[model samples]
Target: MERISRKAAEARVLDLDGREHPLRSLWASRAAVLLFVRHFGCREQAVRLYREKGTIRALGAELVIIGNTVPCFARAFREDLAITTPIYVDPSMASYRLLDIRRLREALLSGGALKHKLSALCGGFRRVQTRLDRSQLGGVLVVRQDGAVVYRHLSEGADDHPAIEEILAALAPRTSDEAQASL
Candidate 1:
């Protein structure tokens, strides 16, 4: 799994529509919010999650979801939830691996060092942490037209995360001129 450094060059990711959507293009053209959903097995869940959170209009950034689930399932789920954000299907787990997101809760559960009895007792705890972390998967990367990561929120665990408002603020142009200039 590759860690995306704050200084790394911007890369393009495919939309759920499978278009070669470039991050630079979005920065140059408009502000974008890349949402990484790990173990996104159902699109309905994705849609409900986003919709319930009001992610689309609240963030005012392009919604880009990356996950290791079937696109068809995601699509159906999104449709059921009435997600307006453009969804992207990362069937290959390329984005997940690139972002270094854990794909399975069980992977983290049994792999940790612990006594046999302790492991079993901690399994439930690990599962909860994994779910929480998965909910916060994908670092929210705010970039500029020149491909600079102006702001980044990389999580060390599941609970610590950047708020939607903070992400919107990061996506906001630094100056009025800068904001207008992009348009």
Candidate 2:
């Protein structure tokens, strides 16, 4: 559990196309979902994210998935999943560390971890450790226009994640045109 300061404003990531840009550059809407996946193969959360991509867009937000792996892995995952959300590779895991996303060995005891593990196992997904840090963990941070992290959820294990409804609640537009009309 290392101290992680909010330095996302300065963090940069290499997009799948090998182009490097500041993490904030993806904030082309009301906010951006900075999702950090432990590795390239972990697809449960990714699948959910893929499904929720359009909902996120309707909130005036963009979804960016970042994985702690090489560019090839990132590209392959994006293509295989046909993910339209921007994906990035960070072999160095600079973004993960800076965001305080770390490993947890006691995940088995963490609430819902056992169930999640069981779910993964039943889903035909094996926990084959990767050459990279597979236990690195996952996280979600909602970044607003000012680079401020309005909401953050760090996983306790591979399966840990904020519920899709929870994320959408936090991301829903603060005001819609209908509401603005009243003002």
Candidate 3:
């Protein structure tokens, strides 16, 4: 339940259409579940987020996927996954760096990484990627309209992700005093 700093909240990101937006814009008017993926080719993360989109919306939160690649890859991913949820990219990775997201190159050979790939195959998702940053891990954040970050999860490795239930729980309404303190 750590709060996002002002600097991180103001970091810039680009939409699939290549328009820039401040990081807070995604949640400025509603609760947002920001999913930072390792890369657009990571179908396992894509499918997992896509599957949780409904439940997340049911809890009055919007799901946004942020990738660390060019807009074209994000666009193709949206089409491939048939994702209605909005997608954005951070080519400069300023948001990632400000949030202290990890970059672990050695994790590529970890057991969890292998498990994720196998899971993606079992789920009928496959993609061949090249020349993308594989070491940059991603995480999840639940932010409120007023800039209160109710939940934050920094990935330990490329295969790590937060539980959907934990994300949903973070969206539960907070008291005025609690919300005020976070700001």
TM-scores, all models, native as reference: 0.54, 0.80, 0.88
Per-residue lDDT of candidate 2, residues 1-183 (tens digit): 122244754577887777787766766446788888878777778778779988888887888898887777787777777887888877777778777787867644456777887787788756644446766888988887767666789987766778888888877655688446634
Question: Which pairs in model 1 have colliding backbones?
Answer: 16-87, 16-88, 43-74, 43-77, 44-77
Off by over 4 Å in 1: 1-14, 17-28, 41-60, 99-137, 175-183
Q: Quick one: best lDDT, which candidate?
A: 3
For candidate 2, the per-residue lDDT at 127 reads: 64
Show how many residue pairs clash in every candidate, following the order shown.
5, 0, 0
True-vs-predicted CA distance for residue 168, candidate 3, Å: 1.4
- Per-residue C-alpha lDDT of model 3 across residues 106-134, encoded as one tens digit per residue: 84878997887787778787865733688
**Candidates, ranked, lDDT:** 3, 2, 1
Error of 3 at 31 (Å): 0.8
lDDT of 3: 0.84
Worst 10 residues of 2 by lDDT: 1-10
Runs off by more than 4 Å, candidate 3: 174-183
lDDT of all predictions, in order shown?
0.48, 0.75, 0.84
Clashing pairs in 2: none
lDDT of 3 at 87: 94
